[model samples]
Target: MFALLPLRRLLICCLSLLALAGCDRPSAIALDQQVYIWQRQWRAAHAQALVASHADFSTLRVLVAQAHPNEGWIQARIDNDLLRQDGRPLIAVIRLDGQLPRLDSSAIDQHIQTTVRNWQASGLNLRGVEIDHDCANNRLSAYAQLLHTVRAELPAGLTLSITALPAWLSSKALPTVLQEVDSSVLQVHAVSRPEAGLFDAQLALRWANAYGAVSSKPFHLALPAYGVALTENGDVESEAPLPQGGSRRELHAKPEDVAKLLRDMQAAPVPHLTGLIWFRLPLAGDRRAWPLVTLQAVLHQQPLRSNLQVTVQQQGELFELRLVNSGNLSAALPTLIRNDAAHCESGDGVQGYRLQRAANTLEFVRQSPGQLAAGQSRALGWLRCSQLDHGGFRVSP
Candidate 1:
């Protein structure tokens, strides 16, 4: 008994060391949480929100939805909607179902953290952090472990959420919800079906109940407002900017159909609905879809325009650019053509515009699409080039 005392003490010391090592593991939730934090900071510095109340992640510029009244919005226009409130934390999105963007965890962490911090320094308030991505039911264990590691690393007060598929909540995977998530979100828009189709709204509601039952936190459900335009066979028609939402134009959905869908949602009973998230803002609601242009006046400060489209194809013998200039007369005047996607342009037949040549290609130096007379349209001459590998050809005017 006397000899066992030292051995027992040694055993206890070893056990304590083991516990400390376990505690030192990084938290997966925390890692992603930081990513969201950096994104919020970036948004605050980069983008300006229309509604001065709170940062609206639901805006078209979702990626940079961290801007607010105090922080100035970036002069550039890159439309996205990820935050609904002003200067809030970024919702860092990572797709777990598919192959990893890259294998190295360090690489992933560095990239994510750098992005989040850059955003935060920009002036946006880093409040709510979210990761929007898909994960399989069977692989939930690995994902849960990752989340646990991340949660350990993340700072307090930063909200964490994950996007879960309907199949994940199906009978078998439903039970593991408690082990995996802090808060959950159900994406009503289905991305996958191995054989036939996705779970309906009723089925989705049941999954929500099951998920909410298992987890202690309050989870939210996300649904699309303008993203559900379908073809004759229920396939997505076209992913265009919800008329005037962003750069999207030449969409197929009829103007009247916008309000019609809203009416249907209101009539149907969506229960346990903490809040409704329009999956996307600018892409779903544009000036045409609404009455008297309330959304446009409030959201978009200037005239709405369809995204500039440039189609490069072989026409007869000369290289051709099938361009669609979409915007009302209010945006700008169009005078000269410019191509910036490629540093080279084929300005064989135009004057007053600048062009640069490098190695073996001609590039457009500047653009003045706004120079065109408002409401009027014109097509400049094409460059006659038989060049086979013309991969660097684009048109902008």
Candidate 2:
């Protein structure tokens, strides 16, 4: 018994040390949330979109300029009045064409300096400038030198940042490149080939861990809030149509997947991870982007639920069918909508559905998959029936 006393004391001391270490582990902190408004053209709807997202996002990263090899520099026609009215910290983003064999460093520096001066002169609250150039990993050293020059050219009070790619993880010059900027944004979405799809949560998590391991400065993760269409000709389209004739596959970033990623990051908390910057603020009637309601819910970590209801509005012998989503999440359009009616003169499906007529029944079959955003309604079809049973409508999702 006397001999076992020292061993028991040693075991207790080790356990106590382990418990203290566990307790000392850092708790996850609330990260700052920002958004990107990448629209090249300023429209009336952009004002409303900015207002809708103003409460959730603390900073706005706006695409102010783009440099192309052939087209040279094109400045975005932003609505300065609307941006002034919105009253949020703005980060002007300058995108350089990645295909350029070499950069015009002096021209880039001049553009940056001029844009900052012009934006500030317009009474816009410009806080930072971000350079978005997806240069190859091997070109990182040259990219770093460009960043260093740009950083020096920026106004004294403004911060400088860069949009980084996961491919740079293998480059030894990554540290040197990072050293030139005040911050970096790791864009994990849409980095892979279109065949691999838009996003992979597990792979993104691994990249985040690896980034955190290497980056000494705070970095933000640029997540996708929208999607794109991949054409058979190996072309990706967003907000435009390709002239090529072929079938296209639409890929979307699921809100649930992003929410789960946020939760996972919060639980584990990557070192030097500062915040999340969602790509492209959603505007009303923007088909490719997630609805503002759904995006807001995901940002706040709210539970997602979508309730789609098929309702009928009648006027004498004419009946109109509509689908409404009352829940907070976006719902998929129903594959089938069945209704029973007797002696129907004419019936037609209006939107993305096809009308099928059978004895004593009218069926509206979806022609293609679509989403009905939360709090939105769409007209399915109309029917002119002598005797229409309003209660005989069935919806299959």
List the candidate 2 regions with Cα displacement exceeding 4 Å. 1-26, 339-346, 352-362, 385-392
The parts of candidate 1 lying over 4 Å away from their true place are: 1-61, 64-90, 95-104, 171-180, 191-200, 228-273, 283-397
Candidate 1 lDDT, 306-346, residue by residue in tens: 33443456665566553344443222323333443232234
Question: lDDT for every model?
Answer: 0.42, 0.90
Candidate 2 lDDT at 220 equals: 98
Model 2: worst 10 consecutive residues (lDDT sum): 1-10
Superposition error at 334 for model 1 (Å): 34
Q: Please, what are the lDDT tens digits per residue for candidate 2 over residues 320-372?
A: 88989988788889998887756788988988999997787788999998888
Candidate 2 residue 5 C-alpha distance from true site, Å? 22
RMSD per candidate (Å) reads 24.8, 4.3
